[model samples]
Target: MDFSQLKKEIIEYSKTIGIDKIGFTTASTFDELRNRLIRQQELQYQSGFEEKDIEKRVNPALLMDSPRSIIAIALAYPSKMNERVTSKKGERRGIFSRASWGEDYHLILRDRLKKLEAYIIERVPEAKCKSMVDTGELVDRAVAERAGIGWSGKNCSIITPEFGSYVYLGEMITTIPFEPDQPIEDQCGTCNKCLEACPTGALVQGGQINAQKCIAFLTQTKGFIEEQYREKIGNRVYGCDSCQTACPENKGKNFHFHEEMEPDPEIVKPLLKPMLQISNREFKEKFGPLAGSWRGKKPIQRNAIIALAHFKDETAVDELIEVMNKDSRAVIRGTAAWALGKIGGETAKAVLENARETESDEEVLVEIERGLAFFK
Candidate 1:
């Protein structure tokens, strides 16, 4: 069987199925990335989200027996929303980063991979394959970098020359001995823009990120946000785009190729006050399709309260007070107290003074003090 011809056919087939970019590479152990992961763990820089087993992440053979090569795929998501919603005074909106704008990318990429897998198995009946998107153990960026999908950029994203850094990556480890493509040359020479622009200094250095400081990772956590970074989160409800937006390589590089990736403006940039009180089912109906909703409504709601604080939106003060006085979740209730203090008025101060006597949770009481401290 001519594997080279089969690889060519796979590339052609990939385009028909809405895959924006495709590349192939050997299923070699990612030794460098393994070292980086160890170092990130040592510094306590790792977000607890990643797969903990380092060997499983680097070795393809562990994922699937005797995997000969890996195929990497990328799909470009739009950096700007097409259907623009109007923003006006008295109504503050929270922003979800571009990565989480449209439909959840994991499902979209997985659908593409499932199609590709079927195509490969049709021709080579004995072909064995395993695939993963972001949730998978293998590092998608490491595979894409080696597979020539794109150069690994300083912002810790795989930046395709054509798509900039705004692309979703996925990979398939297979037994096919397909020839590998040459990797792209790094084009981010002498550029410190992404590092300088990071709100929390999450970009420890070019091509390295301390995920603990990354706003994108922090937004997904269910716990209360640390006070120092609260203001730095700005109006971001989910994920952070500062580093990607700061990259000059991404200049004028927006693409609307995938229909499913187009965002609904009102949902992605929904009003902050309404988010404070949105129901579980209501949150699902509006944001469930978006990637940012993966952690469920609590994190998003908590971030919304913080965004209201960031804006100092006086109009949201009433809603913030309600959340502080009535919300069941201590994180939500405490965050509302914090927001109320940030947006202080006679009413905000009164609510906190009352809550100080009634609030029971140790963590909530601490946040109440942080809130009241803002008044001082």
Candidate 2:
């Protein structure tokens, strides 16, 4: 097929597959993208992966063994409901980052991308393509920008004129030598609103974000959070929306989250008392399919305890004590101790003292003493 005919067919096929934005680019556009990945790794933005692991991302060929073109796609994830007010206050509620309110995007986007890949194979037969939805080694946002899907905002999120930054990104690496789109100029001029609005100052002067300091990253992390950073966690149990919420460009835009994406009311706004009382089995059953499930029960339970402490809800002291004293997970105990300190009272003080006596974990012991000092 001629290049002009190929581009037209590709765009039409992508739109038919439910993607709001589609762009194509030569795989070689990643020459500098590799350097940026090294920089991000040095800055500790990538949590699970090491610097060497990210080096592999620079090679599009590594993503699909032999990639000549990148077909980047984006799906808008609008939030129709006022997610902020969906849950009542003081409930040990678990708020799903709006991205995960309904059916998992991985399933939806992967299915759609698979259909598109099948279509390409049928047309070109020799056209080899691999589907990727925020997975694999390709730098999706970088590819998205090269494909003209959108410019990367100061917050490092892809921003399209039609949907802003509230969208899911996916890509297909293929042997098809399609025409590439030039990246649009960045529109984030002199606006530090997203940076200023960060509750924990995760965003820096440039578009750099210290994800280690990001509340979104801290909350979802599996283990005991450092005591100093605990207070900054606020009420966010999963992903944080502060940066997106503060962006002026997103102002007045209508949200339209799919019906299946709506968060489970129980998951959205769970009662603290019940949350503290549930067993691991119950936690797994409730949050298994949700984004929060990846970290397991301890991190979430810890966040709930911290929320109770933040709200100064002393009523949770007894439940927190039970977990601190008896729960097998050291992370949960540490969080309970942290919460007891935040919600100081006689019961909290006594529990703190008792936990300090028997706790062997150095981190949990430190949190225990911090709780004890709060009551003193």
Candidate 3:
């Protein structure tokens, strides 16, 4: 079978299907990435969301039988929103990171991969392929790097030259022996922008990140955010974009290639106060389409409370008092207590004082005490 001709056909077909970039690499074990994963594990810097087994993450052979090559594809997302949310006094908004601006990238990338997989199978009847997006055991960034989709940036994003770091990546491991593309040279040279711009210094150094301290990671946590990082979180309700926004390479690199990736400004940057009171059905109806809502309403609600405090939004005081008094979740009630203190009006202070007497949960009680401390 003419595998070289088949590979060429796949490349041409990819363009017709809206895949922004496609590259191929031999399915050798990723030794460098394996070592880095070990180091991240040793330092306890990894986000618990990753696959725990490091071996499966680095070896394509384990994921699919006799894998001969990996086909990496990228889909560019818009960095700038077409419509703007009107921000006025008493109606402040919180921002979701650009990655979460539209439909969940995982679904979009999976659709692309399925199309590619079907196209390959049609050409070679016996072809076997395994596809994955971010959640899979295989590291998407490592595969994209080796497949020449992009160079690994200092911010730990796969930085594609055409689309900057604002690209969604996925891969398919296949039994076809496609010639590998050369990896791009790292272009971040001496640029400390991403490292310097990280809100929590999550970028330990170039090409390394402490996910525990990353605002993007922290915003997704179901528990109480650490006290030290709460102020730094600012108005980000989902992920943080400081690192990507700071990179020079990404400057003016907005792409509105796919219709599904367009942002609904009101949804992505909704009013913080409304988020606090959104019912489960309402939350699913509104934010359910975006990737940022995957952790459900608790974390986003917690962050929204924190954002109100960051803005010191006096208008949200009444709602916050209600949450502190009546919310079922201790984390939400506790975070509301903290925000009330941070906002600190006579009413906010009075609510905290009242909750101090009635709040039963030990953790919520501690947060109430901390809230009262702000008044002193």
Candidate 4:
């Protein structure tokens, strides 16, 4: 197969498969992107895994059983009008990080990439392809860069002049040696918007962001997060998009997602009270396969309580009371107690006392007391 013809065929096939951009490169796009990953790992900013995890992904042999070439794809997740509602004046909003504001990209990207692979095999009966979207062991951002879809920004996200860093990336590892594209030159010269805007200072240095300090990781993280990081989480109920929001390059770009990715109005901009009231069963019914459900309702519910506390919305006091008094989960009870203190009044204090009397979790009792302390 001629590389030139294969390049044209790959691009055409990707578009047919619903991917917005497609590029090809060798499996070893790791070397160019290693510095950023190492810097984040060294700072203990990485989440989910350590330096060893990244090393495993970068290893082409591991990325694919026997990787030879990469066919990278990008899905442009352009921001919508509802996604930009960040002001304090808005009514209690269901806070979906930009990524969650649409259909789960994993399903969308996966189905499309799989179809593309099937198409390739139909053309070349012996061709084998493995596809991934934000998963797998390969360094996707680096692969995307090599494919000419975008360049890596200081925030460690791939940036395309056409779409900024909002693009969701996926890739196919295949033995096909399709013509590879030249990598783009970095365009984030002297721009520190992503660095300056990080709440936890995760973007500590030039083009370096600590994933551990990243709010998105915290919100999506399973199990209890370090208490110290909890206070810095802000109002993001799911993921955090602050750095991407601050990037000048992202301004004025419009994306029309396919219908599969539209945000559920109820979940798109959720009311704080309803989010708190939702049962685990209801949460699964509404968001189970969606992006935020991966961590279960606990983190998101806890995050809603924190957002209520941040807003100091007295109206949420009754709901917070219910959670403190009735929720079986200790984390929910504790966060509710904490939120009540922030919304303090006679009613808030009463709920805290009730929780203190009956709560079994020692940690929750301690939080109930701490909440009472704020009132005194």
Task: Provide the overall lDDT of each model, using Cα atoms, as 2-decimal numbers.
Answer: 0.93, 0.76, 0.94, 0.77
- The top-ranked prediction according to lDDT is 3
Q: Which pairs clash (backbone N, Cα, C closer than 3 Å) in model 3?
A: none
What's the CA RMSD of model 3 in angstroms? 0.7
At residue 153, what lDDT does model 2 achieve? 88
| Tens-digit per-residue lDDT, 103-154, candidate 1 | 9999999999999999999999899999999999999999999999999999
| Model 2 spans with C-alpha error above 4 angstroms | 49-52, 82-92
- Tens digits of per-residue lDDT for model 3, 1-376: 9888988899999998889999999999999999999999999999999999999999988898899999999999999999998766799899999999889999999988899999999999899999999999999999999999999999999999999999999999999999999999999898999999999999999999999999999999999998899999999999999999999999999999999999999999999999988999999999998999999999999999999999999999999999999999999999999999998988988888888888889999999998889999
> Which stretch of 10 consecutive residues in model 3 shows the poorest summed lDDT?
84-93
C-alpha RMSD by candidate, in order = 0.8, 2.2, 0.7, 2.6
Q: How many collisions per candidate?
A: 0, 5, 0, 5
Clashing pairs in 2: 78-257, 92-272, 93-270, 101-261, 102-261
Error of 3 at 250 (Å): 0.4
CA deviation > 4 Å runs, candidate 3: none
lDDT score for candidate 4 against the true structure: 0.77
- TM-score between candidate 1 and the true structure: 0.99
TM-score of each prediction: 0.99, 0.92, 0.99, 0.91
Lowest-sum lDDT 10-residue window in model 4: 81-90
lDDT by residue (tens digit), candidate 4, 160-179: 98888888899889877676
Model 2 poorest 10 in a row by lDDT:
85-94
